[model samples]
Target: MSNKIKKKKMKKRWKISALVLVIIAIIGVVGYVGLQNFLKWKAPELSGEPKVGEWYRITPEGTKSANGKDWHSLIKVGKENKVIVYFFGGGLAVDEYTAARPLNDDGGFYADYADVDFGVKFGIASNNKENPFKDWTILAIPYSTGDLHAGSGEYEYTDLNGNKQILYHNGYINYTSFMKEAMKYIPNPDTLLIAGFSAGGFGTSLLADDIITQYFPQVNNVTVAVDSSLLLTDTWHDVAENMWQTPKEISDRLVSDNITLDSLTSLSKKYGNKIKILFGSSLRDEALSTYQSYFRNGILSTTNENGDIYEKDLAKMVADLQENIPNVGIYIWNEIEKNKDGKNLTPHTILPSPNFYGKKYSEDKSIADWIVNAVNGNINSYGLDLLDK
Candidate 1:
């Protein structure tokens, strides 16, 4: 072979070797960077102070997830002899559950938005902010756990800080654990109010009777306020095919089903005036339809082993209880004006009143006033300035 050819071959071999080394080095750097990120990455935390009208946290309770993640609970102090432990309706992922409404890409709905805030505000104002009731507290638990907040259902919200926690999926049956942990942060046990709206309200009624009765009997006082909860008696499942189809339908079914309050009436009998219930309802509401659809879907039926058509068959449980329980008071808002032009307005969370400042929807003073009266133990007269105050 010629000397020139041999030199050229050696030069080519060197260039190929150098190219291979560069590629290998690049691959190694990329892998190391990827692995480092995988090890260090964490979900963002949601944190903040309670709004002015809202209650602030006094003690933070630590929570451990099934996976062993640690979290803390927040609190809002009330003044009345009653402490309201609030469980918010659906929406958002976590921190925003306590917020008036979750700001979703598709917009939000439900009377619960107004119901929850109004209830809280009423509690604060009824006592004239002096909190005549001692050791009163409000626990606003955000929905950080399920898919219940999707679409317009986004009630729970988490912000930039990884603070607000979620409900453990299997935790409903195990909610006692969360309740037990919550007791640690409470100011007192003698005076406690457990309440919620929509599904939350339903859960509160169920838990108040099942868990509160079996476990926390020392809690001499129990006040339940449910605004359009979707729960009816277990028997209601027989006619609940429409329960999972629409919000308005669901509301009608639940109201008709006779589920949530059926067992509540008996509480007052067992515990006397210690168990007081406040129920707020609207005559015309479509949110119930939305809920009926959500609940009547095949999943809950199959899980509970219920027959078809659950919503219809559900005893007008609330209505039936209303007739029986003298202490279980209810306020029915007969005519709710929805629009400026006088269209038939459905009772919804977002309002048309101008009171809401940072809220995503309009506000209504009538609902707010009613809540104030209910929380203060005044059922008959709700002092509201619908006109010029």
Candidate 2:
């Protein structure tokens, strides 16, 4: 063939190849987006009896997230009759300003909805041998409603953009609704653990009494563990009563800004030594300090000064709990991580993090080991001296 004819054919072939490459790229992008949506919204049906050691997502009817999306929970059928009801943690929205912006909106205050696969791979929810609750049947409750899993009201507030919005703070309704369905699979338990982290930790303190008295009353060996939950606001009682519309029993317990302390103290008084109560926290949790700064100064900050203030508040909290609830088991750790500014800050929560099994309170005991001991009724406090550092 002549040189001109050959060059013309080569150019045509190159054009066709480029077009095919663009088409292929478009298909790949479309497929990836579709898969993500599927993962986010898909709810697995609990058709037959749940198989042993398998995780299943259960979406109960009439349950909704803070953003009005359908809410679902997770369960893992276990080898033993013992059970762990774990509440997952997200941030909170105390008022109109915080409510307008959710975690997805870069508000940094609260998560508007729960993801199906939130905490399945770490801490107590994991299948790792190091997890003491690994084989225990787990009913994992995901948090989204900003009410710490204890609200039953719809709150209307004006957003930062001056748009009126209604937040469905339906945490209480979601938990009860899903627990009713979860009971069908793991009906009766000889030993039970009700636990949570961060906002869910506060939920553990607030809802443990009602949950035990209502659902698993017959389980004698009951334990409640609250991890890394602290929020100091003088208006908590009013917020609980009017904004969240929590049950009167829960609302009544919120006489002070320290809801975790109030709830746990009251629960201790009611249950006596019948149930194990455990609490865990890092010395200077960065995320919690940020929230505390917002609550105290009306500015969200994670400065070392804010962290010191959180530590001071934590010391007071620990002292108050020890004074009021003598039997409560405390685990305080000083696990440091660098913040965005490269300053040292203790992490927010440990129970749902890899550090649950990796970090140790004593040279001999991992946090996992301490938890296992508490579950077996050997209640003791660890790392109390860390408060001074």
Candidate 3:
């Protein structure tokens, strides 16, 4: 073959290869867009008048599940100027296919919650007369993505069987969606209380900065409350960052010095005294500690011959959080009234317990009193408590 002919053939092959690559890229992008459009959820109708004190399953924006399935938030409208926004408690998981979240409108995210009824003590439960926040407009968010409610990446999770599943970490997206709709109901609230438990607590912390800086910059009476989502579980911190796309989703909004996935007080550490944060968790949170084993079972054993090894880890993490965050206090539950497991101290989430409103933190005060004091702008930090045995 002539040298000129061979050179021409090589050029032709190179051009063909380049064309094929470009075509594949285009197809991939188009396919992604098509699937997204197909799965996009519409805003649920929010025009009906909710009964004064009745809880209703209403999706202000009709926030759909990551896979376009039905998901809902529990809403209760009130005539008060104060508002409380809460997130439900559900275990964070890589195997969310079997995770406990509301798969439809019939059930609630919490085991004890009803579709349109209000329970007392939980972040969402403010229906009792003993609680000071009873009259505040309540908006309780539900978790579905199993991303600790703060992810923004489209990632893949591999189950125990080596099967890969694509997941949409859309917690941050849902936050924006719900917030926009929420403002319509509680616009210009005189007092805003934000709290969540377990996975939802992490979500509250993840979005707290923005909720203050961006959403309601003018609302000075804001208290960020956390219930039992001990972000200090260092074993799965990196996994959560990578799998949930934490850095990509919330790093810019965090906007502070050294706010990596390694930091236990990522939100409070950055804001310092500028933001008021209240944290709560039981020392012997069996359910939370048990769930922790799923992610760090081989790495950090929770149980040993002497006691739960994670206790040390939890202690250190809590201490570090106290030292790092300047304007923060904690409502710790070291004792439980009832110990079904026969352990010395049995407690998991403090807010969900009736103790949240009834247990005496002092001679004449309760957790609800502390919450009211915080909400009233009488801000003070350095709180660590133990419920009376």
- Our tally of clashes for model 2 stands at 0
TM-scores, all models, native as reference: 0.49, 0.88, 0.70
Compared with the true structure, what per-residue lDDT tens digits does model 1 show for residues 1-389? 43234333332111101112222333454486664453343322224533323443322233332112443333554443355555544421211322222323323322112111222332222233233332455555433223221111212234225555332322232244445654554444556566655545555554565546644567765566665554333434332222111123222323334556543555555566666776654444334533343344411111112211322322244346557677566544434444554444234321111111111121233444444445556654221121111
Give the C-alpha miss distance for residue 303 in model 3, angstroms: 4.9
- For model 1, the run of ten residues with the poorest summed lDDT: 11-20
Query: After best superposition, candidate 3 residue 281: deviation in angstroms?
Result: 1.5
Task: Please rank every candidate by lDDT, starting with the best.
Answer: 2, 3, 1
Model 1: lDDT of residue 268? 50
Better by TM-score, candidate 2 or 1:
2
Whole-model lDDT, candidate 2?
0.80
lDDT of 3 by residue, 236-313 (tens): 445455666765546444333222223336666665555667766666665555445433431212233112534554
| Model 1, C-alpha of 347: deviation from truth (Å) | 2.8
**Best of the two (2, 3) by lDDT:** 2
Q: What's the true lDDT of residue 353 in model 2?
A: 66
10 residues in a row with least lDDT, candidate 3: 11-20
